[model samples]
Target: MSDKPKIKVLVVDDEQDIVDLLKYNLEKEGYEVATANDGIKAVKVAAKFIPDVILLDIMMPHQDGVETCRQIREIPETKKAFVIFLTARSEEYSEVAAFDVGADDYITKPIKPRALMSRISALFRRESKKEQENVQVRIKDLIIDKTSYTIDKNGKILTLPKKEFELLYFLAKNPNMVFSRDELLQNIWGADVFVLARTVDVHIRKVREKIGEDYITTVKGVGYKFD
Candidate 1:
């Protein structure tokens, strides 16, 4: 066995067969697995297990996946865990809402196990690469510390959610370089991530709201750049 610690994964769905299948296959791949049958239970299980990734179903009894994700984000213990929405719904609006509430990725149902496993592996590899590059980027008065996932603006620390912080960091990293929404989505959200380009707009609006207007400039009909 490799010396690296096993990845913890929590599979959440109301469908028992689906949950069982995911747990079995994930365990087969050497991931430490856990399962929850509904959204409410998912929150409790996630808080306790603190899994590195959560595969959440959108529709569930008592509470829905969006609500469950919101609750999980609020809980400090599980807030940073990567959330991937596993839904049958393929609507663009649903994807937007998922990203709005801190979802890291979205996947449509009837997914092949092999494809899902590949995506999961990619997520971990991306995270490992991020960990290795802990360079602190200072852009104007805003300081982005990739190591701590913190942003300091004008001597005061700004409280930003994971996605918002990531958006800011990506733009600030390449200061003055323009990034189209598609490019931002690919770079920040990862190439395998399923999200609409509008998701970048939503995150940009939120980031500008917190960080002030002057830092990020919108290039007409193109995209945005860190000013």
Candidate 2:
């Protein structure tokens, strides 16, 4: 007999067999699991269940995962939910699109249970440490508290991921000094992380979306700034 707190996971897809497969394998790995057949329903289920992570299908019958992810960001309960896209799309654009919509990782479907678990575990480990920082970067109307990891815009609480918070933190620390995407990827996401330069753009877009549309200034071919 083994006793460990089960990590709750939400698997959203329109296909019945896929959902069942993921549920079976995830439970086998000692995780608690739930399911949703469409994007809107995914959000509803997530809100009610408060899953630790959400495995979303990019293409579904209603709403689609991209839009669902955008909406999930607006919900306080699921705002920081670890999001991974499980899709059949293989195009680089699809990958970029997934990140742009706020996914932490992407896995093409016909997913292997072991690989999925590995990726999920890695994200959990990274996030556990990320949850402990102290933030108090002052940018006009916005105040980011690193310890609490929350953004307040003119007294309103904002939902930002642990990674986005760090990106904003580094930029805010130097306010007006531009950092190249590669530089940001090294300093913020870590030099060891094999992620695309575009990932930084995705995170920045999400940060700007939450703080204000004009919060982050892009230097076009260069990098970004907090002016």
Candidate 3:
């Protein structure tokens, strides 16, 4: 067996068959897998499992995936975990809501296991490459550390959800350079993942909310830049 630790995955859905399908495939791919049939239990399981990735269903009983994702992101242990919403809902609003709650990817499903596996692998592959660059950026009172995935703003350590941290770090790294929404999505989310351009706007707003507007400036008719 490889010495590398298995990547842990949490599969949350109200459907037992879907859970079993994902659990079986994920384990077969050498990941450690955990499952929960409802959002309530999913939160509990995620707190303890601290999975590297969470596959969540949006329409579960007890609570929906959006709320569950929000709660999970609030948890210290799971804040950095990647959340992907796998739902049957195909509405544009559903997709927007998923991204608003910090979902890394959204997929409407007949649940093609092979395609899903590829997407999951792609996420890990991108993350693995990112781990090689252990650099930090300092501007003003803010310190963005890629190694710890945390920010020090005026000596107070602040933690952001994974995507928010990455968006801020990326912009901060290339200060004063304006990047269009499509470019940001490609660079941050990668070409393999299909994310809406509006997702970039949402993330930018969120990063601003956490770190203040003085850092990122929105240029009308253009995109955003780190000020």
TM-score of each: 0.94, 0.78, 0.94
Q: lDDT value for candidate 2?
A: 0.81
As for candidate 2, its clashing pairs are: 133-146, 133-147, 134-146, 134-147, 135-145, 135-146, 135-147
Best by TM-score: 1
Residue-level error in angstroms, candidate 3, position 113: 0.6
Indicate whether candidate 1 or candidate 2 has the larger TM-score: 1
1-227 per-residue lDDT for model 1 (tens digits):
58998889999999998998899999998999999999889889988999999999988998989889988988877777899899999888888888898999888998678989988888878878877775688879988987667788888997677788888988888889999998998888899986788899999999989889999999989999998
Note the Cα lDDT for every prediction shown.
0.88, 0.81, 0.88
Best by lDDT: 3
User: Residue-wise lDDT of candidate 2 within 56-78, one digit each (tens)?
Assistant: 99999969888888887677777
What local lDDT does model 2 show for residue 79?
Answer: 71
Q: Show model 2 residue runs off by greater than 4 Å.
A: 1-4, 139-142, 147-149, 153-166, 173-178, 186-195, 202-222, 225-227
- In the range 30-140, model 3's lDDT, one tens digit per residue, is 889999999999999999999999999999999999999999998987887888899998887788788778788887888998998888888878888888775799987
Pairs of residues at least 3 apart in sequence or in different chains that clash in candidate 3: none
